[model samples]
Target: DLDGDGDCEILYGSSDGKVYVMDHLGQELSGWPQSSKADLQGRYGFVVSPSVGDIDGDGALEIVCGTLAGHLYAWELDGSVISGFPQYVGRSAKSVCAVVDIDDADDAAEIIVHGGKSELWAMKGNGTALSGYPLELGGDEDEFDSWIFASSPIVLDLELDGSLQIAVGSTSGEVYVFNTDGSVVDGWPVATGDWVYSTVTPVDLDGDYEPEIVVASADGKVHAWNAAGEVVAGFPVTLDAPVYGSVAAADMTGDGANELVVASSSGAVYMINKDGNFMSGWPTSPSATTFASPIIIDVNNDGALDVVLGAQNSALQAWSRNGELILSQVHEAGDWIDGTAVASDIDKDGLVELVFGAYDGKVYVIDLDTPATDANLAWPAFRGDRVRGADAVSTDSDQDELPDAFEMAQFNGLEQSGADDFDLDGVSNANEWIAGTNAASASDFFSVQLSYLPGEPSASRRVRLTWNGVAGRCYTSWQCGQLDEGEEWELADPESGTIDCESTGEMSHEFDVSADDCFFRISVTR
Candidate 1:
């Protein structure tokens, strides 16, 4: 399930104190055989999704699960249960999950979960309790509050930190984040409006590896948050009332851009894409009572994104990535209906399958027979001219060897990581030439070319480029690649029609690097 392996491993915990593992087909891999017999398993159901990872580096991914019985279970891939349960620092039973090397060390990521009387807890890998004791993030200060944990915590690298951090949302309309060291990075009490019941989905729509947070608020509005927790862009729904039901974010378009799918209390489904402006163009929406979140799947096996919604008391609705309704499903034990749906290649056949939880306490598996997704495609957030809400730079801002994607913006088409340094020396070509040191001519160290971009209209009143002649040689070299900042010029290339040298003050000379890009004016040191 980790990497589209198409293996539907049963990642569930029983109150019986045992963690059970089965392939996507529901065959017993029996991860922790003895776990079934653990007295610590408690005699109830483990409602939380199984947190799977190999904390001991034994090459086997283990299960770290919590039970309503107030115990934490660590089950191994080979069906071997850890001897003792890690202390649940929280005062009450809640949810739990484990991440890998959160601190960037050989040690696995620490474990943390919420619930149980408004509290949070953190622990080191190998069951070592954190030194500062269990840390509580957001709990309903109001006891017996309608709910404590709105949804399972979503994890992403918010700080662009290689290490992943956890984002937890509360029924009180709060969003909180914490580092692996049990430190709170930022906490906002007004994150979402009342009843922001849905989990904050993290997706990088614009091809940025960093994911953006999307939350559905009871205010009947959906708000998109940047990594800093600022509300970037959002849309309000008129139907299904204002109570935000649930929200999911993903790139349904093979174009690398992501679309947002939101389910409302009125059972209405909505879809939107980040197209220059916020575009709400979902070709599909079921007017059923759909409170659960919709998951992105390749159901038709068309290799395109599909939408699947677990309806409330209604049949499950499946739509192709393009919004073509395909399936209307009914479950045998449909109670509250679909609780949560996440996609995975549980079968490990290179195709992703939909894995969702039902209020009936049973997990449903649906095969999405589509071809493996092309991970290389840019997500909605990673593409286009705008980000979150403002104008977005390209991933490669500088076209230098060092990409602008590292800067997380665009300078032309280069990404910070893929920015090209025309000088091949680290300085951006724009930076080198902007100061007007003449990036076009190398030896002169004082000449640069002014270029008109591709396809600029000449009807806007043409202006001619002019430069004084050099003191000596007519063909002296220019461009030092070390121009000061904020310098600019415009020159026309007679050959490319970019610069009509035939006009007055237009210097005429054969261009050394012409045709690829247009030129306006050339700086002459003489």
Candidate 2:
């Protein structure tokens, strides 16, 4: 497409370690070359993926590609090598990702790529890595074993524990889940009928706003698992044939529910709904086997989705949202297509284009160039945002019976649900709650250096501090001023402090505050 025109073009990179610039007709531009002049390498025997991000923050774009040679390369638009080019990943980085901050503190957005075996590494764009080496999900002490590691991991927001998790499928047919903080949650594994070959894809399969992961196994089955890793049904339903490519997720049937698009070695494309219900329609098989994956786009501005897939026969096909045969481009001159990827907005005209990788080690970009309108070129509908496990799930959005952190996340950042009670002083709010004389109103009750508490026996009471919200959170613990490496400020897990739960609502405990103004939070669970 002419950049000055409203039309668009596709841009892609390939397996031979070269990048391609193409015209709308899948025709090479006069100045285009099949291989990059940069002499970059990422040959992992056969694995590669190129990611697009404005690394230099320049208006122009950049490339971050991984290779079977276990190296990651970053290149600028001028075809010159960037300072961060060619970083090691132990051996072959199968996948690369940008870290989504789970703490929600707006930390730096570094790139995270997976090395072969069980290693996960976090690195800066310049390839400067954090202190720790790549960490393994399952240590040698863990009894669990993956059937064997072959599947590329799919990142998902499971655990709903605030952050998104890395969902990995092992050849052993076991699905392993880790917290966004990179720690193991509960141990529950899904036994796919066969080895998992594709990356894990998660969508709100049930449309409850919660997402479910779709894992395609080599045993010719696509299994669905919930956040807990339990097989939703007797999954492992047979697909048309054994799977090698990744399973695609998007609203394919035009229904509100998301559909699973599976591409097979037999070159068949099948669509199944959330319930694993297959559509009555199955498109005819293409002339060549499809090891390359499938992608979705709304090609005709119908507000519906279109399907696109690649084949080793050097064919790239696109189906209309309603399954109508629309566009096909075959490059007789190029090597067999090995991997396919799509990106939108190269021209920023609101429409995205198509890109694919070939065995010739060159990337190809072509204009999706369909009659897609702005309505048809919709971005991902699911824009998930929320990260932090400082508190358990906030069941009472109204700030009722939970901790201040629970209430903090919901309301403008404070709830007097009374979940935190560090002092056991009948009050369980936050640092905002403190009453030197009375322990009941932690929120409204600010602290006063207690000159005295009555030498004689005094009644136990709760001290409540007041913040704008009904509760307060985060306090510098006076009992344990500064925490050491292993120190934690916790009352008692099972014990409810010196006060008895059976003592009725009037029960309270008296604990001395610091001579200086110290911070603390209190909650009333009982």
Candidate 3:
């Protein structure tokens, strides 16, 4: 867009030889819908997207794109082609060029254009070639297996040095990391077995502060390389289908260790750990195909990062860090998405919205306000704590009221809640505790009885309540005049109470019945 006006314009190039500048509403700019028809009318077309940057430091970004005729052009916001542009570099420059400060001069950003089977070129803002000119980053020319630089160039600091390096992939399955002078790194140009159409991502997968290169090759594998160009341990993990989307890294498991996330042509999204193992509940298939790189964010404000990506099925989906699908929305009817769906709080709202471009010549802005599921809910809680007990499910040998995992924790696996009474007391195992009785002893049971002590000199009908009292527990005896009216039970004042721990763990209380008919109950509280 010409300015950050809260709405962005689409700077798109088409095979019809046109460069249209349209807003989010799909309306063309005043003098836009420009074209390269005059230069190569029926000869070539545009296959690469226009790269935007402030080439002249004019505060306004300019649009740059390469035509199928190998001509690169930069245009102003008003569709005026920047003079001295449309420079012919090679046969074609189809891959998206990265606008970066490759020379580190800080004067202006240089354009890294892919020369499609020719060479990788670095051009100044005014269309002049850099000092090193173009470098042979792909296959050799005039060869049967000459490779094409079909992937975009990524600029990052590989060695954590002050200077940045350029990482790009070729159709010949070679991954090259080049210094700013267009020179290859020490052990670079690593070769995979297949083509690489996805952009390379440099991330600190092991939290070493030094970035590692991660690339998704068309041979259905994801490879990671350290700064020295050595394959990272357990890398090049195989997937089901060819992966065309760029790889992303984040602490998906909240382990402080980053996981490599990549999508494939078969619509599968994989979250591989640093040790190259598939995370539990991963390789999720959100759509039939996912070609765009996945974007990682804490969409639900979750401490763990989540994933957001576009699918070829015209839908945008978001997944939890544990690989559970959280939310999804179909954005287009028939147009499949081709670009990464950017996530941000576009409306200043807490929830982020997803924005992306599609194959139907339209851009989409989808709202993603769905509340994030508790990360543990995506898996399971072993004993109530979310972080641990990941394997509690299988370790639960007894499928009863309480899992065997926490059995040893609460009790010695003796306080079972089943029907069997362990103390030989009349109260069952479940009822013994509530009745203030010892499940290990028959004499320590809670009892309420009515007795007529006619043999005593002062005979009176008495209601007796007896129960074993714990030191910190208070037991209240309640009585109702009649149970027919569903009357409330009132606390009963005991005539006497006694504790005898010598013979058994026993305590007792007695209450004289004042009414002819009475119901009694005991309530325990700690």
Best by TM-score: 3
Which portions of model 3 show Cα errors greater than 4 Å? Answer: 4-8, 23-27, 38-48, 104-106, 140-149, 298-304, 327-332, 345-351, 370-526
Writing each residue's lDDT as its tens digit, candidate 1 over 27-76 gives 66633334422224233446455676656665555567765544566665
Worst 10 residues of 2 by lDDT: 382-391
Candidate closer to the true structure by TM-score (higher is better), 1 or 2: 1
Candidate 3 lDDT over residue span 75-135, tens digit each = 8777888877988867667677676656756646688877765578888878888888688
Against the hidden true structure, what lDDT does model 1 obtain?
0.49
Give per-residue lDDT, candidate 1, residue 130: 59
Q: Distance from true position, residue 120, model 1, in Å?
A: 2.9
Residues forming the 10-long window of minimal summed lDDT in candidate 1 = 381-390
What are the Cα lDDT values of the candidates? 0.49, 0.50, 0.64
lDDT of 2 by residue, 1-526 (tens): 3333444444454545554545455665444433422213333332444444445444444556555555666665445567976787654555533333233333333455666554666566567775463656432111122222245544445633235556666555566666556665575566766656566766557544355767787878888877777676645557778887777766565455667777777777777776776666654454577666777666545556777777777767766544556644433327676565564555545555555666665556565554433223322111111111111111122323432222322222332344655335554443322222222333334332322344443343233332221121222212333545775555422233433233212222345544332334444321
Query: Whose lDDT is greatest here?
Result: 3
Superposed on all Cα atoms, the candidates' RMSDs to the truth, in angstroms, are: 12.4, 12.5, 22.6
- For residue 284, give model 2's deviation from the true position in Å: 3.9
